[model samples]
Target: MSEENNIPSNAPVFQIQRMYLKDLSLEQPNAPQILLEQTQPQVDINLALSAEPVAEGVFEVCVTGTVTTKVGERTLFLIEAKQAGIFEIRNVPQEQVEGILGIVCPQMIYPYLRAIVSDVCTRAGFPPVLLTEVNFQAMFEAQQAQREAAASPTLN
Candidate 1:
């Protein structure tokens, strides 16, 4: 084995490259009527996670969420959120980048994203929303396996 291999290269190194809002939108369908009617608007929320490679050793992990509300047949509001974090990812093997992005980076970015989503909703005159933790490692591995499976067809 070469010195590089003998030295155990998988050391831990992670950095925050940047953080920004990739997208955001808010809408109130029945602006005047919804504002007047106050009957605890029904709320529904959904969330998703994603990551993209930006540079050789940098990747961005994003969490997006949508909130929908209705007050007795009239749309009260719609709030969408996209919070992203730029991560400086080095020392990890190329084969493991997806794992890092899917699993580790999401873990790091989730809190900030949750806070952003909650804060935004609160500022928009709604209660704060606390999103649940995501299983990025599992999601990453599943995606990797899918890609590998796609690349190499098998005989069933």
Candidate 2:
């Protein structure tokens, strides 16, 4: 008789342990004057993602967003927020780890980061700055391409 278990012991494992707001900062340098401006303030947003191993099979992934609103030469307000998640990943192929970290993990955590940024802006007496949906797969591909280009030697 052949005996085989339903589940494999080394099957790929991926799980989210926790998600939370890692850090947030709001700065209104020219508050009173900038607030009085009749002209619409220009909004600029920057986002960054990072992942690091925290334990044997645990990783911490973080997404940071920075929003800066400007009225002409004056700064209206700036908001920087970092959202992080603790994920457990194991038994996966080494080749797939990079994609899982750069694309999959960020996709799971980005929505919460967006909501937090918008909520903070609204509570701070400013219109909500809704973050647009991101294509992490495309981003990861672009980054990989960039790294490859950088690594390859140019012919003289």
Candidate 3:
């Protein structure tokens, strides 16, 4: 038992402390008039991910999605949902931490954001808008590429 005391723990630790809806908003400018339209409304979705360090080993990640449905020039319904999670990331390399926060954390919280958007649209008297699966890895790669390009000097 005395020999075990000499050993040190170097295992990585990552956990979600809590997940909650940080913000939500629903707007129906056309309302009854828009509902009367016989044509199918077009939907446009926008997504964003953000991370902030709250404590020494704790971070907050937010996944935000906005859905807008329009019938011609008029608006049918617009809903925005923000889902956030508090994560504890310790014993991890500093360089890898950014990727974990950008890709892994957002992937974990995106489903909840999608559900909220669908539920809000359905409850507001519209068909449930099923959100497609997002590729966080690709997004992260693109952002990194853009940063690298910006930092490099233009030859022209």
Candidate 4:
């Protein structure tokens, strides 16, 4: 029974310490004139995820989203938002750390990022830009494959 109690201490642990909006920017470079255009503006959205070690057994993961709406050659509005979370991951295997950081951590942080982007857009007097759900596992796998390909020697 005592040995069983000790097992939990050595077991893997993953926890979210806190989540926050790390940065947000809304830019309407060509606001008044562009907003007057009758044609629908084209919307472009880009997202990026990153993770870094904050302390021993603690990591900060972030999801950044940029939404740019354009009316012809002029810009309507641009929203850039970064949402981050601090996670505590302890006793996890080294091999699995990369997957957890690249996939799971981003999965946890992305919804908040989406909300921030949408809210900022609506508050800026533009229609809300809803970010589509992401498949972090697929993204992680593709990144891993890309890294592997880059590391391999090319024979011409």
Candidate 5:
């Protein structure tokens, strides 16, 4: 137990650092008539995740999604969230860096994005939307496993 106390105070730290919108897209299938309709709309949401390195020790992860709701094709509401974060990682292994950016940082930054999406949707004349939680850790593991499988050649 005594050996465990020797861990340094400043170890490899994982932090959100900062989050922003790298890009965003919004489309209304029936904008003109939808603007004139009055009804409670049902919504459908889709989420997408992507990560890319900008520079050494710096990376950007984008979590984007679309919300489409229609009052019989009148397009009651539609919005998209393109949330991204710039993470500063140091002292971690190179192989682990992708997981850090793709999984960890995005998990930390998602709530803010969710709130933003909910608020934007509500303020845009639609009901508030609550996005479901994402499992980034599991996603990371899956990604790593896929990469490993791809790298290994099969003897046919």
Candidate 6:
């Protein structure tokens, strides 16, 4: 019982120190002319997530979203938003940390990215572009599968 009391604390700790918009850009190349067109432009959106260790127990996670709208051959507008957070995670097993960063961190930052994208589009004088919800677990699993496949040998 006494030895148990002497053991150092290894309790898990996870916290978000801060969340911020690291970068934002909007481009409207065909501004006035494109605005006059009555036809709706087709919208395309892409997303990516990354995490890196900033300190011994702190990490920086970022989710980047890009949106492009085009009417026929002309480009109506384009926007890219990168949302980031500083997270402090300690005492978690090494194997689990990757999952937490890949899934949980992206899940937390995605909403902010979506909102920023919508707001940027609306403020640029076009209709708001709503981003669809993402399933990070499925994405992570797919990425893992691809990595494994690339590493495995292919039979001729």
The best candidate in terms of lDDT: 2
**TM-score between candidate 6 and the true structure:** 0.92
Give the distance in Å from residue 93's predicted Cα in candidate 5 to where it truly belongs. Answer: 0.7
State the displacement of the C-alpha of residue 46, model 3, in Å, after optimal TM-score superposition: 0.4
| Candidate 3: tens digits of C-alpha lDDT, residues 1-156 | 236765346667799999999999999988787677799888999998899999998999999998888888888888989999999999899978999999999999998988898899789887899999999999999999999999999996
The CA lDDT at 70 in model 2 is: 91
lDDT of 5 by residue, 1-156 (tens): 136776565567555667887665556667677777667777788877888777766777888867888787566667888888877776688778877777777787788778888888777766688888889888778878998999999888
Worst 10 residues of 3 by lDDT: 1-10
TM values, all candidates: 0.72, 0.94, 0.92, 0.93, 0.73, 0.92
- The 10-residue segment of model 4 with minimum total lDDT is 1-10
lDDT score of residue 147 within candidate 1: 88
- Using lDDT as the measure, name the better of candidate 2 and candidate 4: 2
Q: Candidate 3 overall Cα lDDT vs. reference?
A: 0.91
- Tens-digit lDDT string for candidate 6 (42-96): 8888998889999999999999998988999898899999999999999999878
Please, what's the RMSD in Å of model 5?
A: 4.9
Candidate 1, residues 23-102, lDDT tens digits: the string is: 88888778776788759878888867888888877788888878788887778888888888999888867767767777
Give the local distance difference test score of model 5.
0.76
lDDT of 2 by residue, 5-116 (tens): 5667777889999999999999999978778779999999999999999999899999999999999888899999999999999999877988999999999999999999
lDDT of each: 0.78, 0.93, 0.91, 0.90, 0.76, 0.91
The positional error of residue 57 in candidate 2, measured at the CA in angstroms, is 1.4
* TM-score: model 3 vs. ground truth: 0.92
lDDT of 4 by residue, 49-126 (tens): 889999999999999999888888788998889999999999999879999999999999998998888888888887
Cα error, candidate 1, residue 42 (Å): 3.3
lDDT of model 6, residue 112: 91
Task: List where candidate 2 sits over 4 angstroms from the true fold.
Answer: 1-6
